[model samples]
Target: MESKSYLPKDHVDILPCMAAFAVVVETGSFVEASVRIGVTASAVSKQITKLENILSLRLIERTTRSLKVNAEGEQIYEYCKLVLESSANIFRVKDKLVDNPQGLVRMGVPKSLYATCSKLIPGFLSAYRDVNVQLVCGERFDFVTDSIDVGIIVTEKPPEGMVARRLFDVDFVLCSSASYISKVGLIAHPSELAAHSCIPFVGDLDKQYWKFRSSHENCDVPIPGRYLSDCPEAALTATISGVGVSCLPVCLAIDALRSNQLIKILPDWIYKGALQGTAWMVYQPGHHVSKRIKVLVQYVMADLSRLSTTWKLM
Candidate 1:
């Protein structure tokens, strides 16, 4: 038996190992990839190392501060995405054969829509009991690279190479705590807003320019704020706490307005613009369209249409 030994001691399956490597590259960290795939960090590292050994190439550069995919790894990542997508399609194929929306649907949801999404989840699940959902939320998203089935985004234009269906045009209503408005006195016109303490929306710029529109006139006001933030919830909190007057989304401020926590200023003037911003359901049209994705999009469109009737959005 000792004399006849010529075979290798260890054998490895390439599929899962390759998948681990892909996830690592996609997430850009061994720890994050492990969390995504439900494995240990050591396991993710070993799999990528094993894949590198098999190929006889260093796909990624390992540093103490960062892990970067080299040129070769970038080329390999494209193929890896194809491989993983093909593997994912196997489930889609099965679902098609069975004529049922089953298995998992990975969706990217923006944090701003937490309230809307919470309302939609129960109804969607009840309609398709066999379909399972996994929602991924973050400050930023790249749907193509992250393997998201669909995404909800707020933008005037969709990301290049992705398809979009317009959900609604965002309308901003000027809101402030009743106390703030009472202290500052009434804002009879859009021009009067310039004199009051204004809480402007924070973007990449130092100053935020707010535009107001109507059938007869338009006004643009450039303003500054001490307590500036890019988050909607933060802006709403500051407004409700009587910090200053801010323009907030109608959907988000509906309950507050109804409860009299926040008072709407300039009742007839519209600050929301289609040219300024809009909400969309975006996805890669070239990718496989699973039954689950189709139904979810339909559900969202139908639900939002119903909700819009109450809030004056389309």
Candidate 2:
């Protein structure tokens, strides 16, 4: 004695069929609808048949040569048209974003690479006026918890499940201010460092050795720290201020070396210390990358490429 509901219980399951029905109605041929929908004509016929079975109504009258929409089919076609339009609008929004990107793109950067990363951001924002960048500078980064869109890290091997672009190799070299070198005299060999006031980046006591490698041999000097700091930038600043000879990344020390503020010691030897590897710009891999992040990555890489030429980072 109760009135029955007309709509199917699993209404959400029929969206694809509704879309096919709408396309078929518009095209007036199953083969033509299949072309538009990127499916076979038989597949389109099956979807229509399934839709009719689900609703328990014959929505279309068909013969070998002719096809016609019944009264119920005509009513359903109106609602189906709306559904198709709504689906199209989803992709249209993405297209608009791609053409003219506008949004916030958060970047995670380590302190070691902060100077280089920060310098490029202003130019990126100037070019993309609608997009803004937020630099989350730290020693380490968490992609999910930090909501980081992009990150720059120094590592021998980049983490798995990421898209990594190697910017440049980080080369560490022992350098000191010209004044400090003049006072301490020239270091001809690795053993000479032990005699001079050394600034080792000792966050803890365990990292006390500076390993030097030439093409022919390797030398490990145990550093007795007259001045020490964990941060590379601090060590760099101290060395430039004539505090003591400290190991510094070449990219960090290049400008100083060119300006003759810092003098490179033991030029034949490579610093085989803890901080050594290539710096990579990394992001999560996905089929659909946002326009803002995509443009930013391209812009930053281009800038770094130009810098690498001048800095000889390659």
Candidate 3:
């Protein structure tokens, strides 16, 4: 008997390459597609080639000018969309099984939180043994398509279309190493801060203009700093080294305050606002909340609640 030409083994399943194809079709460039998917452009091209070879048809008419999808490619794109949607549903159904929440849960967290909250993650993992958590930490927003399940952001306004659960309100305090403050003299008022060497957290300086309320009057003071860093940790390190005074979240400065490594300056003129910064748990609405996502969210909320009570600035 002659072997079948289109055997199951001979015809590779398209499921694996579906994601790549969808990204390429959407981005219209292999390089951009790779960036969105967090892979190299060559890898994307290879995946597309594999997909075309499996279907025995040219899907994309590649040229320097544009990446146009042929008729076959258009049909495949539609089918892939349906496949992905169906796959999402399958995952949703499977998620109902609490016995195991086995799958990747990509989470985005702030760098400062990682410094303080990284310790809590081990306990979360221990409790949810089946859930695989992938934590991505950064100072800036990393909100690419399908990249994260939950994002923890400290912002005044939440992004549109995403559910925002106010985890906690954060306050910033003007702090410095005891030696630094001693050398520069403590700032007694928001205006006095101009004389001190302030360290600014990059991208937040404009928003960080120190605000204080006194005797029913509000003060918004714009202070200059000689040092600036994108990472809060860097700012903290600089303060610790006696480089300058810095405004940092009370949560991040508590240990230093207790240890006398850093001293709170301008105690009377405390910066106060309605949680100048809020930590939010954001996720796309309408997407099925898998058991892993649910468990992770619950765990994080519980953890945040505990931290807020213990470390929240009054």
* lDDT top scorer: 2
Candidate 3: global Cα-lDDT? 0.79
User: Model 1: how far is 77 from its true place, Å?
Assistant: 38
Error of 2 at 114 (Å): 2.4
User: If the candidates were sorted by their lDDT against the true structure, best first, what order would they fall in?
Assistant: 2, 3, 1
Which residue pairs collide in model 2, if any? none
Candidate 2's TM-score: 0.73
**Which 10 consecutive residues of model 2 have the lowest summed lDDT?**
199-208
TM-score for each predicted model, relative to the true structure: 0.59, 0.73, 0.62
Ranking by TM-score: 2, 3, 1
The candidate maximizing TM-score is 2
Distance (Å) between predicted and true CA of 29, model 2? 7.1
Off by over 4 Å in 3: 1-97, 138-146, 156-160, 203-208, 272-275, 312-314
Task: Summarize candidate 3's per-residue lDDT along 224-259 as a digit string, tens digits.
Answer: 778878778899999999998887878888888878
